[model samples]
Target: MGAGIVGLATAWQLQRDGFDVTVIDAHRPGQGASFGNGAQLSYAYVQPLADPSIWAQLPKLLLSRESPFSLRLRLDPAQWAWGLRFLAACRAEVSARSTGTLLALAEESREVLQQLLADTQAHCDFTTSGKLVMYGSEASFAAARHQLDLQRALGGAEQHALSLADCLRVEPALAGSAARYVGGIHTPGECAADCARLCDALHGALQARGVRFVLGAPLGALRREGDRLVAVQAGNDWIEADGFVAALGTGVTAFARRLGVSLPVYPLKGYSLTLDAPVGSGLAPNVSVTDAQRKLVFARLGQRLRVAGLAELAGHDTRIETRRVEQLRRAAREVFPLACAGTETRPWAGLRPATPTGVPIVGRVGGAPANVLFNAGHGALGFTLAAGSARRLSRQLQGVAERPRTAAALIRSAARPAENSA
Candidate 1:
């Protein structure tokens, strides 16, 4: 049970099917990854992060203390197991399959999100401002071009390769920093929206539509009745439903463990900073900008700019490091300097549950409970893929067969909940 974008999306879809829906969460809506995310609904740029090129970057990743991507080898067996699987997924073929799977899901998500927006008059600063990803090195640019080709082959959106000058022309805010990049890729139909706002809007809509919420109560346990989850223990209440979904994000791993099951999911911690990006100010970018080298993404949300990056794998820690925040601020400031005046900085860190292949698990694992499903392991693309996954899971619960068997194979695992003990 969760109240983030994914959980809320699932609840909304289930409510549409006439199930009495209830969202369970430890806190209020949008306080998790749904809050202060990169804010880019990357519809077309669905390339899997477990790429082959990461092999070459492993040296810098392992040795450099100042590196943005940090890896701390913990004593936990799950970390090592997940790490090895992640390495195995770094092959070209695996990446291709995953790209296909993600693109299909992303396309569906785009449609679902559009339909959701149309149905509700909720304002979350959603914009089709497009996305521009800048690559500084020729190698990186070539990789980006290859990724663009892959997406095109999978019938993705119309994306254009832009030279440095073209990048500056398209978004003049990058003019000051365009000297470093060789070229970039601009994907049309891409979007940027406040994820926290969407979560809030969904919460309000669900309430108005008669959905229930059990907030401020941390999930305590799952009381299963042999091959079926009859109820969930939240604080002092045991709420039962016809079916249950584990969409707890990072907490899904722990909750799954309580069910005597192990998930390949691990938390990849990422940070963000929100800045004052006033309208008509040339200092901020209206279109979403992704620095391929730094891994930081800048998206303009209303009058604020969301700057987010870094993937730190170090257990379940959610502490915001002042130095790391300073480092991110320094890098972002260097690229987009505003003389450090009249700008506010709001820092945030979140634990995004990610699988090895950067692919999410939508359906259930075989031998789990018959009525239990999983909608977690979305990693960083949680916002981008929430609606699609929710819709897919909804179809599964209703016994509606899914088409395009290939993509569905990757999105949904073979089983449901397993060994429903305790």
Candidate 2:
């Protein structure tokens, strides 16, 4: 029950599949986390969050004030449980397997997104600008090349491994940081789009198709009748549907718990800043740029630029930290001094719903009432994976036989309440 990108996309797909779908959200569509995202449709981003290398950097990361990822020590049982699972996922085999699965889904998503944009003609400030992942050190560049090897082994589109000179040739705007980068990787198939604009466009298109949207309707309770979810109570109004899909993002875990399902989703809070890109300034990057070392991403959307990164686990808190905001600002200025000339800056914070293994849980729940499904826990790649995840869930709802392993695992996990309750 959400109106963000995931929910909207799922509803759109379901409606197209001849289902009467209704969306309920506390706020207007695209007014939540979807409002200010990295705006990158990084189809080739297959790295899992719990990489084997993260273990080596964990200690320094926890101590360093400049680190992009942060953790808050808490006594909460959920936090401890999630942290242990995350550690277990740091194994080489586990991380590699998850990356392979995610890569497949990412490839499917790219195809689905292209068709959606072309068929629907949604104006979302969508751009076909490619993605450039810039590495700073010899070690990092080597790791990226190794990743390119993995991608090639997976047998998909070939991503070019660019030398520093080649990287500059592709996106000359990076001439400003010519001395800072060792090398870069370029994926021309990747793209960037304004996520909020897409959500708004989808909302409008869904409305035109007669799909119902219940905005400003805060969920109160779920109505269940003998192994089936009958309806949803949204502020004294009862909205009934034949089936229900939980795309609630950060709110999914708690909502699932009300139905006796234990979901291992937690929030990885992130921040973003939008600024105006002055025309004729050498500061604007034509293609999306990722600072691999600092874990920041910059994408051009129309006349504005979106910079997003930093992961903080603060337990569903939406408080904006000025220090983190300044850190992003400082990094932006260092990377593109002329880009920060604009006085107006729109800063935003969103809790990206993440799973321990970094793979999303998208399938029917075993413990939930019948006809209830999920399309959440996408973490930072929500926009990237939305279309494919929704398509899978829609196919399942239509009684499709084939299902992904992660989706099956989610259902199995839901059946065993004692599994992840630590």
Candidate 3:
């Protein structure tokens, strides 16, 4: 019913699995939440934000507007309900389980993304440049080690904790702020690309494969007969599909409510800024870098640097607050200094559809239409997990059964500038 990355990727996977596909969206492809996302394809680091450590930062999260994370209490019941469930998921055990699940999905995604790129040959300024996550404080660095320990135990995650010297050795571009960082986690396999460009490439690729697209109209009412869904109204057109997947991002919550399904999806609004950063210039980072404390991520795609971070739970509002944008500017300038130009900045804000547990809901809904499946609530990882999650949903449409708890089980078994030709 939606056509964000999840929808487009789902169509791509389904067509590969020997099924006809149709993608419908109210906006142009990649113009939704997929647009302006942190460009890094961070497959190794899929940790959820709902950690046991959040308890220690609750005061800052709730009370300090200047903090990177902020939550506004609302009159909406959904917000209250989602908040309570999030609190329950803040325990140590739940966080670990979710991490295992996400890591497994990330591995599956890594494999599938390689295959997708190899087959479709889509180009989005892809780069194989590795990712470095730097921590400023001792406590933050220590807390990251716990996640590395979890990944080490689960397997397949080739991440190593690094001292400041080692971090600089791996990503010498950070020499500008050598004294600012205490430690880091280096994953050389992590990559980045222009996500919006990927969507455009996928949209064109799918169209060439005979897939139909109904764009520029909102999905209207769903026609249900008994326990099955037959068709849906998009503008004035009546489109019927044998099966339906709701990849609506934040729009799924309202869409699901019409069908008596209560999806635990809420919007976590985030901000991003893009600036001029040419490669080979000593000013910009050659690899992806994430500031653990400020929650900012910097990814250089072609000649542009994508700086994205900050979490504001203020419903579906997409307004770009000048203060928040300035904060991002300050952070980027402080970290990269000369890399990000003060002017020529492109500011963007999108609502990241998220569940309390950080695990995406990717299967059929109980008691709802038998053919209606969900692929929403991915939060910050919609980019990282889109390919694999869509693949799982495709398997369901093909009657291929996946192993239960595959994240935990899979562990036991286990781009450069030239990428433009992709």
lDDT of each: 0.83, 0.82, 0.82
Which order, best to worst by TM-score?
A: 2, 1, 3
List where candidate 1 sits over 4 angstroms from the true fold.
Answer: 279-281, 401-422
lDDT of 1: 0.83
The deviation in Å at residue 161 for candidate 3 is: 0.9
- Quickly count the clashes in candidate 2: 0
TM-score, candidate 3, is 0.93
Question: Model 3 scores what on Cα lDDT?
Answer: 0.82
Best by lDDT: 1
RMSD of each: 4.1, 3.7, 5.7
Candidate 1 local lDDT, 1-422, one digit each (tens): 99999999899888887788989999998899889789999989988779899999899977776677988789989888878888888889888877877888888899988888887677999999899999989999998999999889879999999989888888888877777789999986799999999899999999999998999999886788888889998889999988899899999878777776677789999999888785565678888999988888999888888889899889899999987798778877777776234476768999989988887878676546767788888889999999888888888788763322222243333222111100
Q: What tens-digit string does per-residue lDDT give for candidate 3 at 342-408?
A: 3556699998998887888776766468788888888999988889888888887887643222222
> Alpha carbon lDDT of residue 203, candidate 2?
90
Tell me, by TM-score, which candidate is best: 2
Native-structure RMSD, model 2: 3.7
